[model samples]
Target: MQEIFDENVFKKGIGRQINLPFLKAVSTAFKNIRVRFGRSFITIGGIFFSLTFLMSTFTNNVIAQSLLASGTDEVKFLLQPMAQEVQARQVWLISLSLLVCIIGIMNAMLTSVTERYREIGTWKCLGALDRFIVELFLLESTFQGLIGSIGGAILGFLFPLFVNIGKYGTQVIEVLPWLEILKYGAITIVIGLVLSIAGAIYPAYRATQMVPADAMRQEM
Candidate 1:
């Protein structure tokens, strides 16, 4: 019995472990939930449609309006209606993309704060300042935002090509401008980073405000 109790007997077969910090933990949680729900990806697809339609529409609309205002024949007869339709679709698409981004950010931040309540409490009890904890949460949020932004960019770029390739046999897509992509990508990343941190701040602050004893009592 004593020989059977030996800890070393199983040591060779045991594996080492790695530790992940709070930020990484939050990111992983969001990643898992996003995958499991499958809605986030769908939202991303919606965003793609919205973004594409809006950009094309706006581009054509502005050109047509300018040409009309200038009293020029440069505006082709066929292009006006096509441009208007594209513009209308684009408006809807832009709106949808904005909605998706808002919902996604909220979901990620809300889930993160809910799951990490105990860990946050522990940090507070261990003499961590509220601001430090807030910064920690912010860092996690920023990382999440960056990841989402990158993913959105990749998807956004590829989506237009995917759609065009499917339609009209890919004879050099007349739609999908690079400038708009750049503008949107930058805006998306900044907004996402801000939204993520904003979402976490309240929950993190609440956790930090509790007394050490109270904080410690939280369940993992």
Candidate 2:
């Protein structure tokens, strides 16, 4: 049941673009908002749990650091175990972040293509060039990507501060950190834009193959 919630909520596809460029953008942005606030919290939960475990381990091994300081052989033996756990945690963090981003981009692109199939067919039948059709989708996808990426980036950066606000108090959470947001946003948008174009390829091709009469007959 818990897994089902994660699949339905934190996972993408619920909120999607409606074919209008800006509205599509807004829908994609909302999905990211859901991901950042929802999916990320779940992914980070394990990290927090592991950190707690590590803290307990450290408390139990109070003499561990002291042993290393004294160059004891036993301390040297424990180093590998500590290092391995830390490395594993780092890998999990990076992997989960990548997974979320990939999932979000793929979801947005696939949904966009699915909704615009008939529109693509119509364009193809009206003597629209293949390149034009491709470019048109690319532009719309890019626009959607830009909105989601920018909003997600901002939300991601400020999110930690927002969560920590109660603990850290208002004074410490001063800046919004725009530069970092833009950097990450640019990267995400580029990935999403590319994914959007790639996702459209098959759909666009199918649309291109439609006979004019058949395309005209497709239910709009």
Candidate 3:
């Protein structure tokens, strides 16, 4: 019975040890985010605006559809020019905006790695693995993306309502399909998360390649 109890204790210890690296990396990432709140906020803001812009295109398309379905000649005529412009340029605009977002995220993460050179060196010297460093940065960006995406989606959904209300009052707002708007919001969130991860890949890889000695020599 004593031997069995010892084995169980050992297994539990092993399980905790196995989870220690992930927990440490996550904790360190959160600590760094708190310490570098300004940079993180900038990154999140960029993501929020980019996603909001992208989702605005989707919102515009939906609004155009609603206008077309209204069966009012005056409404159709009023929206026709705008609808054509959106159809012609929406894809290009979304693509350009998404590209900008990715670039912004990558730049932010790279700057973060550069600014934290000394801390990273310390972690390396303290026996942190390369993958742990990568994981830490990725996790931080993922959290930022999540917050930014939700904020952007909310703003995007409201944008059309405001515009329509301003143009034709609240009665025009009823034409919108709430369910479709929700679906577009969900897509935007997924896109934001994916962009965050994709943007971090190069910076994370570059960070892993840094020599601890060289990083430590740099001024913070």
Candidate 4:
């Protein structure tokens, strides 16, 4: 029993040691996000809108499927007339929105890097490595993406729910597929995370490439 207890303690110690640096980086990223709340909100807003559009499209498709499965010819007639056109357009619109959001995230991250030149230099001067800097920015963006995606998914789900409620009253809830919502919400979260990470890559790399001395010399 004593030996087992000692082994457990040793494992716990190792786990804490492994997680310490990651915790520090995450905390530092949170501090930077709080400091730049306005810019962070803008980045999140872009993600929110993009994911909202994508999820709303998915919701529409699911609703159409539900309507068809119910064997409601009238409802199907009303929906089917423009379903193909709307489906085609949804692809284009989602792509465009994602492109715009990606650009917004990239711009926001680059601006952050530019504004934090002295801070980055100071961190490097204090033994912070290039990977640490990259991790910091990535963590910050990932947090933003998580928040924005969650908000977008809720908004997207509500949009369709409200519309269907108005049309079908409480009957709408019966046909709505909860599983599909969960699936799409998960996908949206992933997309948000990927877009944020992709957007941060170039800026993080550029920030690391700058000489600490040169970065510190810049006047904001």
Off by over 4 Å in 3: 1-19
Runs of candidate 1 with Cα error greater than 4 angstroms are: 1-79, 165-180
Residue clash pairs of candidate 2 = none
TM-score of 3: 0.85
lDDT-sorted candidate list, best first: 4, 3, 1, 2
State model 2's lDDT.
0.46
lDDT for 100 (candidate 4): 95
Task: Give candidate 1's error at residue 101 in angstroms.
Answer: 3.0
Ten consecutive residues with minimal summed lDDT in candidate 1? 11-20
Best-to-worst order by TM-score is: 4, 3, 1, 2
Per-residue lDDT tens digits of candidate 2, residues 40-71? 34322322333223222322232233333443
User: Per-residue lDDT of 1-220 in model 1, one digit per residue for the tens?
Assistant: 7676676556532333123466654665466445545544443343344334444434444334543444224334534567667667766766776666556655655565566667666665554556665665566555555666566555655655555446323332343345755675566556555655565576556555667576457675
Model 4, range 1-220, lDDT digits (tens) per residue?
9999999999875555322387899999999999899999999999999989888888878877787677357677877788789889888999999999899999999999999999989887666767888899899989999899989988988998788768756656777788988999899889989998999999999888888898888896
Report how far off residue 38 is in candidate 1 (Å): 12
**All predictions: root-mean-square deviation over Cα?**
11.8, 17.0, 6.4, 8.9
User: Tens digits of per-residue lDDT for model 3 on 1-220?
Assistant: 9999999999875555323378787888888889999999999998999899877778878877887787367778887777777687878888888999999999999998888888888777666777888899999999899999999998987886688778766656778787898899999999999999999999999888889898889987
